[model samples]
Each structure stands twice: as C-alpha cells, then as structure tokens.
Target: MNGYRFYTAASLLLLTALFTACQKSAPAPQEESGVNAETEIIPEPNAGSEKPQLTVAISVDIAPYVMKNATTGIEVDIATQALPGYQLNFIQLPYEKLQSAVAQDQADMALGVQKFKDVEGIFYSENFIDFVNAAITKKSANLKIEKVADLADHKVLTWQDAYLELGPEFEKLFAPDSPQRKNYVEVADQSEQVQQFWDAKDVVIVIDRSIFNAISQAKGHKLSEVDYASIFPEATYFKANFEEADVRDAFNAGLKKLCSSGEYAKLLKKYNIELPNTICDSKAHP
Candidate 1:
C-alpha cells in the first residue's frame, strides 16, 4: 500500500512538471502579418503664403497712359488708382525700348505697345486708346506727301525707334535702288526730329498726333498736319506685359472701368490732351 501511494504521488508530480514545461515552451501570438500599429502623426508647416510681392512697369512716352506731370504728379496717381494692390513702378524709356524692357523682364509691363509677332512672349492688355501717326512740319514746308508713295522724293524725318513701324512702308515705296530712299533720316526723339526739320526747309517730321498735340501745346509750337489715313488706317494702342497673365488682366479691367465711367476722358483733359475722334473699346484682341 505504501509503494502504491508513493507511485501515485510521483505520477502527480510528473504531470505538474509536464504542464509547466508546455506552458513555458508555447510561442507568443504575433500581430496580424503586414499590419502596422496605430501611431500619431504631426503635419509639416505650409510655405506657399510667403511669396514675394510683384511690381508693374509702365513706359513714360505716352502721357496720361503713363507720364509725369510737371506740377501735379497725377499721372502716376491715376495709374496707381487704376491698379490697387500691386506696386506700380514707372521706367521712362523711349517708345521703341518699351517692348525690349518687357521681354527682358526689366520692367513688369509697358503702358502701350504696337502689336508685333516678334514680341510674342509678352502678353497685351485691352486696347486703351487709338493712335494716329501723322507728319508734323513747319506750316511752311508745304510738302504734298499725302500718301506713303508720295514721300519718295522728299526728305523725311521720323523718331528713331519709330522707324521699325514706318521703315517697311518707306522702303517699299522707295526701293533701295530708288534715288528717293536717300532722303530718309531717322533721329532719336520726336523733339530731335522736329529740330532737324526746323533747321532745314526740306525736312518733314513724322510723329503720332497725340504726341504732336501735347508737345505743340506745351511748347507753344505750331504744327502743320498732313493726312495720315494712308499710313495708319486703324491703329490701336495696347498695354504690354513683362510678367504674368493675371496681372495684365487686372490692369486691363481697371482701364475698361475707367473708360466706361468717363474718368479716362477727364484725366486726359486734365493733362491737356485733346480727345481724338476715335474712341477706345475695352476689348482685348487675341
């Protein structure tokens, strides 16, 4: 009986030892395969709101559009009022240099530009005004050069930068082989061109009617007008871009508002600019 009891006790002890060994040897259950544990994340800060402010550029050749006044300094004020938020800067470059300044990004935009495909990169705003090219001479020159062809035999003087627009017609009328081509002389500015004509009886200066009127009124000079319909039948003026499209659009819209409300006319009169017969519609040409 004693041996049997000892055997039973040993058997119970072996069972307990086996159960504990099994519990110790068992592997721990793992998280689902390929599943990531939940974790908190902090976002990075945004940087787009720190962009630098931009400036708009305008040429000073065209008065009222972008010119300085001797007394009031109202030209810049009007332009600033037209464009509210962005900064407006003026670079008083000659008409011919305006396009280049925009193309080279030296200026943000020009007040006006003649449409030319060579300057395709720069965008244009709405037609703010119509420009008429005319010949201004001393009341005595009496040169009957009404048509482009009529200028062949006469000594013609024009603004240096203006030749690009006028040279082709002049060349077409007076071919290189023609003797009349020799009479053409291009000068730096309208004032200089006018001086050239003033100093000589045979010379005639060609300029835009607006410029002619402004200068004549300012200096008390009298100019003889010649018919310019043959040269510029439907010339229009557009603002140009050195920057982005949105900025150009804003300026154009402001200009349209000014024109529609008759504020533009008032400004022109304030500067003593004569209103031309042609009116400007705010539509921008594609």
Candidate 2:
C-alpha cells in the first residue's frame, strides 16, 4: 500500500513540471507589436485653409468698361487692381438686372450697379466710377438742349434704362406714360448708339462721355465734329453693392488703396478713358 501511494505522488510532480515548461516556452502573446492594423485617415497639409472665392455680378458690358468677352476692360482692371486678395468669379448680367442679383442673393456683390433706386438688402460701396453722361449731336445739327425737357421736342436716343437713370423729371417727360415715349429710343449698345449719331441716323443720342469718346474715337471720328451737350451736369456714379457689410468695407478699403497708389489713373488711361470726376483724389480718408 505504501509503494502504491509513492508512485501516484511521483506521477503528479511530473505532470506539474511539464505544464510549467510549456507556459515558459510559449510565444509570450507576440509582445503586441505596438502597431495599429486598423485603417486611419491622415489629414492634408491645407485641408481646411483655402482662398476665399467671391462671386461677383458684373453688368457693365460697354466698351472701355467691359468687353464682349466679359473679362477685360476698365471695370475688370479696376476690380483686379483694387481687390487683389480675392478670387473674383464674375457673372455677367444685363444693366437692368444688376441690382436684382444681390437682391435675390444670387451673388455676393454686384459690380458697376447704377444707383437709380435703392434696393432693400444691398449696401453701396463708395462711388467707384464716375460716368459722365450727355446729349451728343453733330455740330451741324445746331440743336440746343438746355435741360432734359428740351429732349421732348426731338427724337432722342439713349442707353438702356436711361429714363429711369436720368431723373424723375426725365422719367416724367419720357417714361412709358408720356406721349414723347414714341420719340425716345433706348439702345442697348452704346457703341451702336454712338455710331447712329455719327451715321446721322439719330439726331440726338444720350450716352456716357467716356463710352462715347472711346467708341467715337475708335471709329476715327474727331471729337471736334460733334458737340456734347452737357445737359446732365451731375456726375453719375456706378458702385459695387454688397450683401455683407464686412465685404463692402473690405472692398472700400481696397479701393481706397488703389486710388491712393495712383493705380486707378493708370487703369483708366490704359482703357483710353479720362474720367471727369473721381474719388481717387479725395479718397485718402478711406
């Protein structure tokens, strides 16, 4: 009986030793490798920072201001020079539809918007471009236009939406309700308007001085041959209307810099236009 007990104890000791050896010799759970096998997303260098893009509504397409390509001209040159930091995305609209773009929130700002009337949500920038408008005629016509009322007696030609732009007095004389409406003609193309005057097809054409000068001079016609009736004496201004005040303020600051640096004059000369009145000289305050 004693010998049987001794044999059982020896067998138990051998089994315990074999289990201990197997645990120590095992691969030790691979030491975890410290590497993450799951997929990870690495961020790009400039993932969130990007240039600001401004969607601009440009309606002025007249010669010297805006060209047929909708990209080159005085307006474009001025915009580029003034706002060098922004990426301007220009969307060409008609003159009549300029303010509607900002009113409807279709664009951030409307460039060259003629301030005929005030829109509700739009904020105007400083008077950027001075558009000298007048009644042009061949010197031989000998037409005397002392005021806007004198245009009622003759067949008058002007740019699109001129009745609204001229004044309430002019609108009263030649608006849709006036009998003289039949005699008043509105031309979409100022170039064509100037050509009609030179061609003797139209006796009186009201147009911007710069545009008329640019077009008439381009046609090899001398300014001496024509008489520009300075009936509209006020310097009409075109402005940029914005939906946001900050953006408008920024544009004003930029415009002030452009004017102060003498870059504005260079742009005007490059476009073959010497505007009569400008904010450049007095814009140092801005």
Q: What does each candidate score in C-alpha RMSD?
A: 13.5, 7.6
- TM-score, every prediction: 0.65, 0.76
Clashes of each: 0, 0
Q: Which segments of model 1 are wrong by more than 4 Å?
A: 1-57, 60-78, 118-121, 161-163, 166-171, 174-180, 223-231, 234-236, 275-279, 282-286
Model 2 stretches astray by more than 4 angstroms = 1-49, 116-118, 281-286
Clashing pairs in 1: none
Estimate, for each residue in 1-286, the C-alpha lDDT of model 2 and write its tens digit: 9999999999999999999999999985543455455646576879346557889888656888888666898888777767777788888887778868988888998887766567777888987887878888877888888888888889888877888777678888988989999988888667777787888743888888888887888899999977778877566677899988888888899888887888888888888776565778653312
Identify the leading candidate in terms of TM-score.
2
Q: Candidate 1 versus the native: TM-score? A: 0.65
lDDT (CA) per prediction: 0.60, 0.80
Clashing pairs in 2: none
